[model samples]
Target: MSAAPVIVIGSGLAGLMTALTLAPMPVVLVTAGRLGQAGSSPLAQGGVAAAIGVDDDTSLHLADTLAAGDGLCDAASAREIVGRGRDAIMALESHGVRFDRKPDGSYALGLEAAHSRHRIVHVDGDATGAGIVKALVAKVRETASITILEDCRALRLIKRDDRVVGVCLEGKGPVAARAVVLATGGAGGLYEATTTPLGNLGQGAALAGRVGARLADMEFVQFHPTALAVSAPRLPLISEAVRGEGAILINDRGERFMADQPGQELAPRDVVARAIAAEIDAGRKVYLDARAALGEGFVRRFPGIFALCQEHGIDPARMPIPVRPATHYHMGGIAADCDGRTNVPGLWAVGEAACTGLHGANRLASNSLLEAAVMGLNAGRAIASEMTAATVRLEPVSLPQMSDPAPVRAIVSRGLGILRHETGLRAAICALLPKAGHDDAAAVALAMAVAAFARCESRGSHARTDYPHKNASGTRKLFTMDEAFAFARELAASQPLSRTA
Candidate 1:
């Protein structure tokens, strides 16, 4: 907002990349916390997914990407990213990201769930995200054209009919621009246990929907299979790459129960997470047995996780880790092209914020970090081409007044979180309708409902018990706020009233 020509919402990998790639363009990067603090970029342990290896062709990578997407991916989008992945990685290297290399000096690659080959280019052995973000942050700091603003939160998009002229801020004043890019991360905060930062509450997606940006796959939120559950509220996440490195999932009896998927110890996150959930549901505690797998390098490779586990009296060097399926990534978002351009003009979305269709129903292991870096660059470059001479307007719009959302949050957290059913969803809708105040949170709730109602099939991460069909629903689904509400109404009207109530 603060009188900048271009404004970015969050300061994660996506926001920083957007600012950096469009160099010499007047850009303002806003963050709810410090630049590297908010969003999941820093916490990412796995590396970027790219076709950097000799044997791994772009076509092969594309095939893996689409296969993981589960028949809902845009073929053109998948092809575009795979083709341009090497260039994006090279850009990261130019920005000072030091990737791990093999003995002969080639880049080290690792395998993850559902990938046909090992192509995850890590920075640190385990903390790949932290290292890459650190480099990018340093690069952004020295850029004269980029203005990084800390402690500012974005409220919503300022729309003049269809185009987004600017965005409203929570504390700071509005900064008008010809174009706005929403790099503001995902909706993990909507859940009880999340690996993402507290700021990631689906604000970007909500902002897009409020402005009528065509959103897809909102129901397909990718839940991390190995987030550690403890006495805390938002559980700390254990990286999937740990499992990629041979960490085994074991029940209380120390029996490995994830043989259903190939590479028993390391399967796709959804499969492993469901396996862990089923293990817990069957009256047994589940743990990630990293002691035998990681051995001595466990602490060195993943110091953050090692320290966290040690804090809870469970050393990864000697014992297994407590894990559960927690909200991780939203596969659905403001639908955008490869260049991060959305349906609406003067607006773009990148990183986890944009549904680029790269991640279809389920995101393969490290593809998230890969998509953020790749798409972030594409969005920034695209934004730089227009509107240098346009009139800049920075009008102050009043922030939306917020009421207590505890009741609504409770209802959503209980009824809408994790596994869902039609009966519980209807009850949740009835309970929240009265309390759906004029707030950003309610707008986000509406966005969730838009895709939730459209897809009756329980495909990918969004599980619907009442309609438990797993096959594809043939046509792509989309819904507006009115339509989502109408579905709720239709469901409510059909159910008979309770006799004793």
Candidate 2:
């Protein structure tokens, strides 16, 4: 008998790329919403980072990535992933993605934040994600061997013996598969203010955790410094490429707050975000001033951003754009290897959902798309080579309850914002622990709280007001759901009622 189709969950860039790379192999692509319309991939404003520039090299790119990661990046993994820049670009292009190029037919590279060189490969100016998704979605639709399931949410993994054989969909019981690949993006939606799709409530982590997969770096959530400071659940990202093009961060009093900081407006995301958060905390409104740098050219350079500004009744050429920090990315997720292999056999994770250690604590601007594509392609190849046809009787499994982040949003937002402390973290844990066993969102939030509380020093994106310095030594944290619950229970039992309340 032929091998069962591989079940790939979530239809973001990673999921789409995985299915496409699988090609003639039978595959099932499941998405919570319509393909291409769901997940954080379509909302990514910054393009992919690749060391394809004439003056740039993979070593240079790796240096910037490591620097941004603070002190915890896995050097070997970062090296291998960054070294595949050229190959990833070529692969994307072959899959119908048309990156923006200069008149000389060279890839048009844009610099962002800490990158020492100009190496961001975008498409359609500021609409990079949208453009790339449009192309890939087209390619996926035409592929003969892939079956696309729209509006289907995968709630849990169906593990038999020591391996994950398939996933239990929300309404569709257990569908058997040779392997299960989770490309379910990040957990940014747990926060009230975020740049990711609201549905991204760490579903991948929750699924993997329930099945005993290890999650690493759960506390390192990257907050973008310039999400449009609008009153919306999901803030629109202003793109770090804007700052890369010479925009400056200014307060309502017209002070260039980041001027004296290292690297200034082009500093690492953690620095910029903290600066912005400080300004907001002090009752000041921060704005991105693109007037002197881009001016009239802003419309041509960032047409999508220009349109978004116009919709909000602001003109980037004339006035500064209102900006603030918002939960932008998650550096922590289901612990996986370079090839997206989890400790659990027959299960894999990619994109923002997998902690491959390429992005240790903080992700370099635009490196997300690169990692997603690379890891997705790598996972596809690995699965194809290792998968085998086997006949196993399917056993009945109960579908998990659909997750709702609403209950845990306020707690998570307060405890795990740009700045964290023991008090807030413990309070969040105390509240989330009670609901975690039944609520997937609460379970994911509890894990993040536990991890954040355990990490005693400030490092990268995980800033702690109480512990204001980086530790002399730090390592990536790996914990299963049970371990997190055990820690939470112990902490809760020891804390006084007054303190927890």
lDDT of 2 by residue, 57-175 (tens): 99999999999999899999899889988988999899999999999999899999999999999998988888888999999999999999999988778888989988777778778
Per-candidate TM equals 0.93, 0.98
Error of 2 at 236 (Å): 0.6
Stretches off by above 4 angstroms in model 2 are 497-501
lDDT score at residue 260, model 1, on the 0-100 scale: 65
lDDT of 1 by residue, 114-206 (tens): 877888898767788899899999999999998888887777678766778888877766767657888888887766667777557777877
Clashing pairs in 2: none
Most accurate candidate by lDDT: 2
Give residue 458's lDDT in candidate 1 (0 to 100): 71
Going through the candidates in the order shown, the clash numbers are 0, 0
The CA lDDT at 217 in model 2 is 96
